[model samples]
Target: MDLIDRYIYAVTRRLPTEQRSDIEKELRGLIEDMLAASADLATKSASGPASDQTNATIRVLKDLGHPALLAARYRGSSQHLIGPEIYFLYTMVMKIVLLATGGGLLIAMIVSLITGAGGNPFTIILETLGSLISGLAAAFGWVTLVFAAIERFSPEKIKLDRDDIFDPLDLPEIPAKKDRIHPSDPIASMIFMLIAMVVASFVPRFVGIFWLDDPASNFIPLFNSAVFMMYLPFILATMAITLTREIGKLVSGRWTLGLALLSLGVEIPSLILTIVMMSNKDLFNDAIFTQIFAWLHQSDPFYFDLPMKILVGRIVIGLGVFGFVVEAVKTFVFWIKRAD
Candidate 1:
């Protein structure tokens, strides 16, 4: 291509379409005129008029950053996922997910060693791989889901907003709508969570009444049976919603009801077992909680030993707190979507 043409392209690349043709024409004319003027000015020299149009074009290109940088000037701020913002988010999330996956495997290895899960090294390695794969997949699944959702529903896609650079004459004032519509309002979520927290804080008391007198009622296997009674609210509250929402949202569109059913299904079975064991006096102390409690009773200043007696208050109040939290999240998400 000609020196003038190359110079024109380099300059025009940064300009928007509206001004590109005009700028290209102006640039082309300027380069040609400058070269012609230079030749006349250098009539006395062997260096030959600023070293020819090619040399002048090379000098001009060096002053400009690049075709991409030039294009960016007229384009203004961007909303692309591959841009700086996404890179930042991806870097952060990647760090977290990788840590989570590694931690899961590390925990699995430690537990496997303690439990003597398998007799052979091969089996242990196999178990470790299984645990690692599951953890990584879950981490990536949620991470992918996050980016996908953000891409689909980012606020920039909504055309109702006007650019900040506005002219009063171009924009007429329209009366605002009475309703303020937004996606996932945090205030509503906070209120709902607070209510759920209150509810979960109390449910165990009501539920624990069923377990009151049975001698076998307190022994819990993986966790303290009394923990089931006292903090059932907290455990069920967090787990039910977190598990259900994650699982339900993964499988279906209707998450609120699925989470509700999931909470009931998950929470009720254990509650039933607790009630049955409590009524039958089949409760056993959690070896860990028992040991810890024994140590605390012996070591601590509470001049009294905390009776390992099944706590009616703990069960009722702890679960009440948990249930209240999960329900609150569900209700908040449901209503916000409904409003939208």
Candidate 2:
């Protein structure tokens, strides 16, 4: 019964929400009928009904094949630019690119506002919007073009080769249920890293504050743009490594020592960069702070000078370090335990 329930869940989960209830009900009824028929046949032969029913259920599920394949069959074929073989990969790539582009543009816009790139807040916002739209369009077009080319010329490249791919005996052992990673975890991490990289590399200026009264001229940039740009290559390299590791996890569906090591590879460099950036005294725009304090001092004569900019930078850097260490240690421990 548990197996049957799990099978039903697996099949229906891939379906649209509106169709799931009906499909689940139908599957349950069909399975029950099959089991009943098998039970009756076994009873006629003086065999146990419960054992026969279990065997019948297993046979029925095996004949039905993978749940994903069954779900696809139920959905029926529809025209698509890419075939099912490569469709999931195509969508994943598109999602990453779009998110990165949008995130980069948003960061750029914020930086522009703080740096007064166009000398006016309105102009900065307009430029940011324009960049975001254009960047998304370009990314979409490029990804579609690449996938379309693959679909057109080399469809077989993405196909699972039955003849020469691997030895059946050498296939990976099935992971323990407890150790198996959920498919969504790596996907979410990939998206998050892509966005973070875009923000760090492309929009460092946006990490600032603005005075509501004079939005155009009273913006304060947190980090020194020139200094941050110097570390762009390292940031990008770390992002690339993280992306590759995440994609591997997506394909493999579990964590391993290799992945844990790669994760540390990403974290170490990132941690170093965070320390370097935070240590630079020039990283905080002191002029902006001075200007803000000067404006506020007029309204509140007793207003004391507070090093909010430095305090905020330290807090952010500290949090980043903490998160990176926790993840790295956790991954390393999991891998070690698995090895043991």
Looking at model 2, the pairs that clash are 110-206, 111-205, 111-206
User: If scored against the real structure, what TM-score would every candidate get?
Assistant: 0.35, 0.53
Global fold similarity of model 1 (TM-score): 0.35
User: Compared with the true structure, what per-residue lDDT tens digits does model 1 show for residues 72-147?
Assistant: 6646656355344345554555455456455646554554443442335577677667756765676566655665
Q: Which candidate gets the maximum TM-score versus the true structure?
A: 2
In order, candidate lDDTs are 0.49, 0.72
What would the per-residue lDDT of candidate 2 be over residues 200-241, giving only the tens digit for each residue?
654455566755564345555666778777877887777766
Specify the highest-lDDT model's number. 2
* CA error at residue 229 for candidate 1, angstroms: 34
